[model samples]
Target: MNRRESLKDPDDLEFFDRIQKLHLSLDQEFLNQFQRSLPLNEVLIDRWERASRLGFGDQTSIYDSSLVLGNVQVGKSCWIGPFTVLDGSGGLSIGDHCTISAGVHIYSHDNVIQTLSSGRFPIDRNPTTIGRNVYIAPNVVIAKGVNIGDCCVVGVGSFVNKSFDSNKILVGQPAKCIGEVIVTDSSIDFKYF
Candidate 1:
C-alpha cells in the first residue's frame, strides 16, 4: 500500500498527527545535572537514597525529575545509565556490575489497590531484586517487584514484570525468555543471520 493508505491504521507511524507531543519541548539541560545535593533542590536525592538503606556510590547516574524510591540496595561498579529511574518504593534491590541503560525505569513502588475503588491509589510497594552482571537495555521497564537473575539480557523496549532466570535472553512486549546465550567455536562468515 502507498504511504497515505498506510496511515489509515491506528498503529501507523503517521499517527503523530493524532497525538500531541509532550516531550516536544523540554529543558535539555537538566538531563546532565546530577542529583547529589539537597541544599540546592527542595528535596535531596542522596538523602532519600540513604534513608532507603542503599549503598550506591554515585547517585548522580540515577536520574529523577520526579522519582519515588524505597528500600533498595545497589552494588559496586553498577552503571545505572542517565535517564534511568530506579524506584525501590516497593522495596527493590539492585546488584553489582549491572548495566542499566538509558530510559530504563525500574519501579518496585506502586499505588495502593485499596484506593483503586475510590479512584485513588495512595501507595503500593513490592520488593525488586536484580542480580549481578545483568545487561538491561535502553527503554526497558522493569515493573513492580521484578527479580531478574544474573547474566541475563533484557532487550530494548521490553517490559519485564516477572522474575527472569540467569543466562537467558528476553525480548518483545511483556517480554519472555526466548533462548539462552551459546558460546560456539565455529569459524563462520559474518554475513549470516
Candidate 2:
C-alpha cells in the first residue's frame, strides 16, 4: 500500500512533506531522551555522533536513527553508518578505526528457529567482537557470536555466520575468505584472486 494513501490526517501528510523538504536531523542528545517517539516507518536521515555516552568511543560516529541495543562497546575512530543495527543484547565489542557501512545489521541473538517453535526451542544469544581497522560493507548481515579480526573487509551483501582471522576479505553467503587485505602506512589495499 502507498504511504500517502494510508495516512488518515491531512495535517500529518503536510508535516511529512515539510520534513522531507527541510531535511531535519536529530542529534544524539535528543535521540537518547525521545528514542521511543520516533516513527518506525519514516525514512530517517540522521547525522549525529557523540562521545562514549552513546556506547561509542573517541571520535566514533553513529547515526541518531540507528538502533543500538545491549552492552555495545566501541573503540576510537569508528564510523557506524546510517540505518545500521548494532544489537549487542548479549554483548558486543568493537575495536578502533572500524567502518560499518550503511544498511548493515549486526546481531548478538538469533530467534529464527525459536520463533517458529513457540518456546520449544531456546533463542541463541552470543557475544560479537570486531577488531581494529575492520571494514564492513553495506547491507551485510552478521549473525550471533561472530568474531571479526583486525583489518578485515566484509564485502557488500554478505551473510557472515562464522569467525575469521585478520587481514582477510570476507564475501558471499555464510561468508568466505575470498581475498586478503594489505595495509601499509599510507594505503589499504584488497587483493582478490
Candidate 3:
C-alpha cells in the first residue's frame, strides 16, 4: 500500500502531522510548583501503578518499574525502559519517537557541590532536553543542562554532561561523537566508527 492510501481517515493524517512536529518539555517554574505542592487527596485504587500517572503525550509508554518525578514531559511515541529514573525537579523534556533504555538515569538537578561543601554551595539546577528520534542506551547517566539534538544516540553506560548537534552518535564516560545518525520518514539508522 502507498503512503497516501494508508491515511484513509482525515483524523489519522492530522494525528500523524502532529506527531512529526512534537517537542516535549517540563519547564523550571512548573517543576518547582509541582515539587512544592501538596499531594491531592484522592488516592489511586485498583489502578495499575504506572507512568500513566504523569501526563505523557501521545503513544508514550514507560515501563512499570520506571520512576518519573517532578514535572517531566514526554512527546509522542517515546519508549522508556525499566528501572529508569527521570528526575525533573529542575526540568526535563523528551521529544518524539525516542528510546530510553533500561537503568538510564536522567537528572535535571544535582547536589554535588551542596553536599560536598556542607550546604555552602547551592545545588546545580538546569533543564535537560532530549530531541526527537534519539536513542539512549542502557545504564546511561545524563546530567543537568544537557541538550541532545535530534536523531542522536548515546551509548551504554555513558555519562552525558554536554550537548551535541543533530545526527551525532556519542560514546565514552564523558560522551563524545563516535559516528553519525541517519533519519528518514520511516526510520532512524546509525553509522558508527
Candidate 2 lDDT over 1-193, as tens digits, reads 8876788898999987776554434333346666633443232534333435675777887776578888889898988877899999879898999999989999999898899999899888899999998999999999999999999999999999999999999999989998899889999888987
Candidate 1 structure lDDT: 0.67
In candidate 2, where is summed lDDT lowest over 10 consecutive residues? 40-49
lDDT tens readout by residue for model 3, 1-114: 866468979998887666443311223333464452211211111112244567777777776667787779888788897679999989999999999998999999999999
> What overall lDDT goes with each candidate model?
0.67, 0.83, 0.80
User: Residue 110 of candidate 2: its Cα lDDT?
Assistant: 85
Stretches > 4 Å off in candidate 1: 1-54, 57-68, 112-115, 119-122, 182-193
Clash number for candidate 3:
0
Among these predictions, the greatest lDDT belongs to 2
TM-score of each: 0.60, 0.74, 0.70
| TM-score for candidate 2, residues paired by index | 0.74
- Those runs of model 3 whose alpha carbons end farther than 4 Å from true positions after fitting are 1-49, 184-189
lDDT-based ranking, best first?
2, 3, 1
Per-residue error for 7 in candidate 1, Å, reads 46
